[model samples]
Target: MSWTLTEEHLADLARGAALLGTGGGGDPHVGQLLVRQAIREHGPVLVLDPTEVADDALVIPTAQMGAPTVVFEKLPAGTEPVAALRALEYHLDRTADATMPIECGGINSMIPLLVGALTGLPVVDADGMGRAFPELQMETFSVYGVPGSPMAIAGEGGETVVIDTRADNARMEWLARGVTVRLGGVAHIAEYAMSGADVRRTAIPRTLSLALSVGRAIREARQANTDPVARLAEVLADTLYGHLRVLFRGKVVDVERRTEAGFARGRARVAAMGGATGQLELVFQNEHLVALVDGEVRCVVPDLVCVLDAEQAEPITTESLRYGQRVTVVGISTPELMRSPQALATFGPAAFGLPYAFRPVEELVPA
Candidate 1:
């Protein structure tokens, strides 16, 4: 089924995508504002289920590349994504059939939608990562063998570059990161152009709806004066994404954050606020990578480590984590696509340079 994405869906979509972002993926406010403006002017963007496209159709993933912090400070020029998309199509010499998200977290979730709104293209319901990862190579598209180049990147300053990094997406990221830094920290990108058949086979399906449901659940819970965190967990459990567990609930006591190498890198310490007499440490590189409780690993990557507000259930990005704020640490299993051997090799605990092996949230904290 296909439906139009109007101003109404933007807020909820942003909320849920932020949840799936773990602790990073840039902020959604800028994307939301730009998309809302586009929607208002262009009527509504159409979002199609993955099954709706033809087997041979060409799909391009639209996204932004840079430190989330940098983009936050230096807003997009609104034309950057459109510039990237057109540049990509010109290079391919084929008009794109649809737009897809590189990931379903924060700003990424809305970028394709915004592009679709502007281009009259249908945005695919699927995304490369069921959640967000800091690097381009970590996407399931790459794990499933989609080449990351012949990529197009458009800067806010009217500059654009078409990159052909051949088979290495890490190289694509390295090259793109350099461009983004030179662009003064943020630019729009379109890449991993693939066939509809391949997208259906590898992409995490229906995750946009999943993000919407999560955002809606939080809104409804708050409206009813109920437990928004529990509502969010229920929303996740409905998908194959696995259950949610509260790893810790407390007040943040320490934060070590810095923007280095065009990424937000840091660790946050949360001390138990109530009867629980312990503290938890979260390590991140743009996104929260692991959660350690009393010096033991409680949750790690390839799974979600969500840091949400204790009362409002709002997701806290790595850059926003500060001292003395009450927050709840939640964990959920990633989509199966993200847990495959190929994906694990790219993004599992070892990929994050952690010394321990990867463990599912369910195993670390059994139901």
Candidate 2:
């Protein structure tokens, strides 16, 4: 069966996308607004099921690669993803059969929907990384041995780059990041060449549904005057690594950012609330990478770390974490699908320059 995006689905989609983002997918607000705008202007989006795609179909996943901060400021040229997909098609010597989201969190989820509308291709309901991550190679594609390079990157000016290299995923990350920075800190990317069968096997199926469910739960709870965050926690409680922790609730007191090798490396501190009155420091690079309570590491990468407002429970991206803003830090774990050795190597603390050995979030948190 197929699914179509409608005006009614926007709120739930945003809520669910935020939850699935596990606190890293960037903010879903702009994407949700853009999608809602598109629906209002052009009507609902046509979503095709994976089964509807031909077995040998050439499916390409598309996403925005860069600082989520830039996205909110510059606003896409509106033609970047279409241009990226066309560039990939030109290089591949075949038109794409369908386009899927690289992931369902934040802007990446809505990007493919816009691309599908612009290109007249059906948007597949599946996604690569069921959540979001900091780099291009963090998807299931890498876990399944798919090459992230030889991929296409495009800018609003119609300029495009086809990255083909013998280097592994990390090196590809280094090169792609440079290109992204050169393109003014963000560009559209389309990668992961796979047949429908490979996609069904490697991609997380029904992620849009998961996103919708999570979103709907938040909206329903809010309408009922219930605790939205608690309700969201309940929806994901079973699938997540362990009980979610309300790591810290406070107001941002400081922010420090520096550009290192094309990544926005920085840390922000928030003053805690109520019984826990202190500062919580969060280290980040595009995505939140670590959380520390009073200078001690409480949670680090490969475990989900996100910041939300204390009252509303909406996400606040790393770039948006500001001084004097009240927020709550939420910690969840990467799903088992991403806990494999290879997965950990790609995104664990080691990958983010932290020296500590990796441990399951369950072991690190208090019982």
Candidate 3:
């Protein structure tokens, strides 16, 4: 089913996208404000079902690329994504029929929506990654065979750089990352241009709707004085992401974080409450990559490692984590498409340089 995305839905969308972002994908607050501004000016943007898109329609995926922490001081000028889209279209010598998110988590989730509203293009409900990943090539669209080039990156100052890495997706990330660094550690991107048929085949479907639902569920649960984490799990049970496990509940004891190589790299230790034994240690590069409980791997990408405020159930981003905050670490299984051998090689534990093999979160933390 298709729907219109209005400013009214931005809050819930951001909240849910932050959770699915798994502590990466740029800051949700920034993304939400950007989308809200665009929608207020251009009216509600239409969100089309992937099946509704014509086979030959040109679908261009757009997102912001940077360390989430950098976005705090380097706010978008609200024209970057549109600038990137126009540049890419000028390069391809063709207009895009629609815009879609490269990743459905964090600020990237809202970039395409901003583009759609600004340009009067419909937004596709699907995305390249059901959850966020640090690198450009980690998208399922690339893993499933879409080339991520003839891409464009745009800065707040209206500078646009077009890169065509041909068939080398990793090279695209290399070049884009270098350019992003030069552009002051942040830029908006339009890449992985493909036909609607390609989107239907490779894109993670209905993730925007899923995010909105999850966010709304949290809000409604809080209003009703019910357990929001339990509501979040219930809301996710029917989605492509099948399970949500609260692996640890505790107070953040320590956080060692730094911005390096245009990415946020860090470790966070959460100790069990009430003087219980064990600690949940999170190691991340932009997004949470692994969760270790007393040195045992409990959750690893491409599965989600989400940390939520224990009482409010609000998802916390890596850049926002602070010592002494009470957090509930939840692990969510990725969609089946993300668990395939090819997808795993692209973004699994091995891809992140972790020692463990890819394991479903449900199996890792049995109910």
Candidate 4:
């Protein structure tokens, strides 16, 4: 079925996208603003389902690759994706049947939508990862054996890089990241060539619908004067391995940031509230990578850790976590699809150079 996205849907899309980001997608606010602005300047975005594309259709997933922090600081030249896609298309000797998102998180969620609206292509309703992760290779496309390069990266400065390297996904990530860093730490990227059949097999199906449900639940709960968090928890109960835990409710006490290997690595400490009057610390790389309660590891990657404003219930991206802001900590288990042995080996703490063993969030969180 075809759908036209309107201004009324942007908020829901953002909220839903945040929930799906699973604590790793960059802040969705920037992308939402970009989409809103584009809609005002252009018009509503046209969305199409995977089935709408021809079996032989060349589908491309488009997104921004960089430090989320840098994205906010270095605004786009407003033509990166279009420029990159056009260039990549010219090189491929073909045009895209439809454009889709690599993942649904922060800016990535809305980027393809905006690109589609401007370029007059239908934005596919599916995505590679239902939630976001730090590296490009973490996508389902990679897991399903799709190539990452022969890809395109476009800078706001009109610099474009198209590498047709036959490198593995991990190597491709290293190469692409190096190029992005040289381009001033961020660039728009479009990659993952796949037929409609491959897309349907690997991509997360009905993700937009899931996002819409999540967003609608929060909105309806607020209108009914119910706890939005609780509403969200209920909606996601089945997929979550454990009950939602309100880890902490407090004001940000401190923030420390450093860049490592082109990633924004940092820690945020929050002064606790109510009965738990103390502190909680969160360590992050691009997205909230880990959570510690009073110096004890509470949740780690391969599990979802997120921070949200106590009042707004909006997600607080790792890049945006700061001092003096009141926020609540939330932890949910990663979906089974993402917690497989192979998946864990790739994203687990050991993968990040940490000493912790991989454990299910259900075993980690207190019952």
Candidate 5:
């Protein structure tokens, strides 16, 4: 089924993206407003079903590359993605017939929507990571052998840079991070130009709908005076992400954060609230990567460790975490593609320099 994006759906999309963001992809507030602005000016953008896409059609992925904190301060000049897309089109020597989100998370989720509105291109109802990951190379496209090159990145100042790297996808991220930091800590990136056939195979299908459904479920649950957490878990059970488990519910006790090498790397310590004993600690580098509960490693990436407000159920990003905030930690399984051997080698806990063997959250947690 095809759907047209209207203004009313914006909130649900933002909320859902934040949930899938798993504590990274930056705050969605700025992005929500930007997408709303674009929609209002350009009319409703069409969201195409993956099956509707032509195999030979060109597809482009667009996202902001940088620290979420700096993005808040600098804001988008609105034209960054356009410039990046134009540059990528020039380098690729082809116009994109459609656009897709690099990942389904927070601000990044909204970027592709806004681009679709601005460019009059349909936004594919799919994304790279079923959940957000910190680095460019972490996308399933890279794991599936897609190159991140001939890439175009644009800054707030309107300068555009095209990158061509064959060293490795990690090197692509490394070079892009360096450029992004120099571009004032945040820049618009358009890369992984591909055929619709490849995108249809590699993209996490229906994630946009998945985000909206999760968000709408929470909204309806709240209105109906039900348990939003349980409702959300039930909502997720029907999606590509098989389940969402409550990892911990507590008040934040400590947060160690630093903007090192242009990435927010740190941990959040949450102690059980409401007289419950013990604590849960989350390790993050932009997004939550690991969860250790009561001294046991309960969940790790490529699985998602999402942190939401205990009362409201809104996700809290790594940079936004602080002492004393009440939060509920939840975990979701990564997309099946991301759990493959190649995917694990690229984004597993061990890939993050953590000494744990890669294990799916579904396997690590009781069924």
Candidate 6:
């Protein structure tokens, strides 16, 4: 079945995307604004189930590639995402039947929505990555054999470039990263073009609706004055991602962050409540990659490490971390599809240069 997405859904959707983003994917606020304006102008977008797409229909995934911090100072002109899609359609000499998110976290979750609204195309609920990753090739679409180019990248000023990497998705990332950096550190991209059959075979299903549910759960919990993290855990418990665990509760004591090589790289330390005897450390590249408690690995990449305001349960992005804030670190297990040996090689601990081997969050931080 298909559903309509109006302005009413942006807040909850953006909130969920931020949490699912695990501190990366750029902030969803800007994307939210762009989506809202597009919807208000062009009317609500139709969000379709992957099953609703014809097996032969074309689905193009779109997103923004850059350091999350850069989007703060370099706001988009709002036309770039759709422009990238149009450019790709032109290059392929065929129109896309629908658009979908390459990543279902942060701003990337909303980019496809914006494109759909502006272009009058239906938006697919599935995505390449169930969560955000710092690099282009980290997507399951790439891991599962979809070529990432011929792809198009568009800038805020209406500039567009297309690349054909053939079968080297990693090379595609390398080239795109350099181009994104050159475009003042942020740009819109449309890539991983696939048939609906390929989308069903590889894309993570229903993540957009999942994000909306998560956001709504948090909002309702707050309205009822209940524990939002607990509510969040309950919400995810029944989803494809499975279990969630609260890893630590503390006050942030230090943060070191910087934009480099098209990513926001940083680490944050949080002391146990009241500055007590233990500490939790988070290392990240755009998104939370690892969590350590007293130097022992508690959660690792491929799984999700999320930080939320202890009081409001609002997700905190990597760029938003600061000292003196009260937070709860939560870890959610990744789907088994993303944990296979091949997928691990593409985005696991080793891929990020972390010494630890891959471990599921449920195993690493048992509830």
Q: What digit string (tens of lDDT, one per residue) describes model 3 on residues 1-367?
A: 8999988999999999999999999888887887788888889999999999999999999999988899999998999999999999999999999999999999988999989889999999999889999999999999999999999999999899999989899999999999999999999999999999999999999999999999999999999999999999898998888899988999999999998778999999999988688899999999999999999889999999999999999999999999999999999999999999999999999998888988898998999
TM-score computed on alpha carbons, candidate 6: 0.99
Candidate 1 structure quality by residue, lDDT tens digits, 1-367: 7677889988898999999999788888778999999988887988889998899999999999888888768988889988999999999999999999999998999899889989889999999888888888888989989999999999888788999989999999999988888888778999999999999888999888888889899989999999998888777777978689899999999998888777888889999866879989999988889999999988899899999998899988887887899999998998777887889999998887989788888999987
Where is model 1 more than 4 Å wrong at Cα? none
96-183: candidate 6 lDDT, tens digit per residue: 9999999999999999999999999999999988999999999899989999999999999899999889989999999999989999
TM-score of each candidate? 0.98, 0.90, 0.99, 0.91, 0.98, 0.99
- For model 4 the local lDDT of residue 35 reads 81
Candidate 6: misplaced stretches above 4 Å?
none
The total of clashing pairs for model 4 equals 1
Query: Candidate 1's error at 54, in angstroms?
Result: 0.5
Candidate 4: which pairs clash?
28-106
Best by lDDT: 6
For model 6, state the Cα shift of residue 290 in Å: 0.2
- In model 3, residue pairs whose N, Cα or C atoms come closer than 3 Å (at least 3 residues apart or on different chains), thus clashing, are none
Which candidate, 2 or 3, would have the higher lDDT against the true structure? 3
Compared with the true structure, all predictions reach lDDT values of 0.89, 0.76, 0.93, 0.78, 0.87, 0.94
Residue 204 in candidate 1, Cα distance off native in Å: 0.3
Q: Write down the TM-score for model 2.
A: 0.90
Against the hidden true structure, what lDDT does model 4 obtain?
A: 0.78
